[model samples]
Target: MNFANTGQMEITTLENFYRDTASLIPEGINKEIGHFNVFKIEDVLARQNKKVMPYNRRAYYKISVISGKNKAEYADKVIDIEHNALLFATPKIPYNYVPQDDDQHGFFCIFTDEFLIQSKSGVVLDDLPLFQPGGYPIFQLSAEEVDDITFIFRKMYKELSSDYAYKYDLIRNYILELIHYGQKLQPATTLYPSHTASARVSSLFIELLERQFPIESPQQKLNLRTAKDYADRLAVHVNHLNKVLKENTGKTTTDIITGRIVQEAKILLKQTDWNISEIAYSLGFEQVAHFSNFFRKQTSFAPLAFRS
Candidate 1:
């Protein structure tokens, strides 16, 4: 369990993201009710060895039931997954799962992004608030609701494995139905601010923050890619943008900006094989020392020490 120098594992494709990870359950063993590729795993467990990351441009999502001693962190929150309960993972965000102790049983299904997009007509996946990276995932499902979702997954799985033509089309439709159901179930507002007139400004700031950092790539050092850069792109006064973000997320514009940079730094520190200099440069720093100092100020540990 001592991964002293944990190397970065990049998942740029769907197949690349899930390879060797999912196990298919045998027939007549686990009760599968969904129409999708529902895999029921009993008494099996896994802990994320490295940072759990996935690229989901293809619009994939995951639904899982974690019974027994299993937990996962979606951002900063740790969730205890219970029996018959539902947890969702959208493609845009990255998450990590760690086992608390030992035995656990669960069923999980992965469906493509197109499955959800179809039902929305002209709408995009990004339009779905729940699919956003920082949003929460755990949903307490009623028995009837759980059964309904499971049945949809089962149907999808059956059609996926069938010999009939246009089976994929049917399967995709089922998956879309599942997400539409989820969208219906989701709360109208987020725990974070969403209704302020400045909310759009905050959202744009987030998108800009995300665009500045590509996953697992070492390009530049953490060279104080400051609020000015973001302000310029937004075509707004730095003070105005800062005021908007402060009113919304309770964080200043610079704080929000640097917070994002430091987060990517932590991911790079723990998951990638890159050295300090390369990581620094990748983060837009001119020198490794500057990145180290900034990281230490934020985290109280140097990048290397934090990874260890």
Candidate 2:
């Protein structure tokens, strides 16, 4: 598939995916996943993109675990997924599936924002960390934790297909429970924090910084990826964010943000076959020359030189 800027499905209706995959569900099992009908499929076919698709660009996020050997190409990273593990998939990202040797046990339940976040839970749901389209999902749950989660999903399946008035509400609660459990499972990253203004700002700033990194598309390139852009989004002055970062992390906001961007640049440069111009564009640099100048100033080497 053409991975660059394929708006093939923008926030696809979950109901339609359910209808299409209806035949995949095994017979005679009532499975409820987030207030919608749950379809359990062992064989899944989807698109896989080259390293140019946006990280947050996906219609639905997936949580999967399998024992059979599997291979995935995400950007410049090709991973051998052969053990019990959990990972995420965004709708905007292009990905494909291959089941190895037919000995695989996997479960996936698809839901839209409508199904997950209703009136009461939507506000809190917005703060959830895994839902971040661009964030990481490398949590390694303990065997007990995995079993617990599986049991919850099994119960959710039963509730989903039942004819009950409050099934939706119960599903919402179950969804919230899963999110809470995930929050506990997440690494001690700064993404999970107590409620505080500065903490909130820091979290938002980190998200904004991550969104620009591991550059994905040319048109989505970063000409204006700077502290000011983030300040505007946070509704705080640039200096204020810098001060917050300095006070919070012992570094200026520019240092932290630029450091993150540069780190990603180093990874893409050294690892990917994508050229300098492509990397620059993905990082939102309007001109490759400008990106080169900035890269040299920060790392004492031009983007191309560093890659070589």
lDDT of 1 by residue, 48-98 (tens): 233232322222467665544456666445666554455677644556565
Off by over 4 Å in 2: 1-41, 45-56, 65-82, 87-102, 123-126, 133-135, 159-167, 187-200, 207-224, 229-240, 246-252, 259-283, 292-308
**Each prediction's Cα lDDT score?**
0.62, 0.58
TM-score of candidate 1 on Cα atoms, chains taken together: 0.76
Worst 10 residues of 1 by lDDT: 1-10
Counting clashing residue pairs in each candidate, in order, gives 36, 18
- lDDT by residue (1-308, candidate 2, tens digit) is 11133332222334444444443432322233332444333533322212121322334555554444555544324566665545545443334344454455545565445456663654444345665533554445556766777776777778866777677677667666666676676766635465677767877787676555435443455544678988998899999888877766788877887776676677667645677888777876768898899889999998777877
By TM-score, how accurate is candidate 2? 0.60
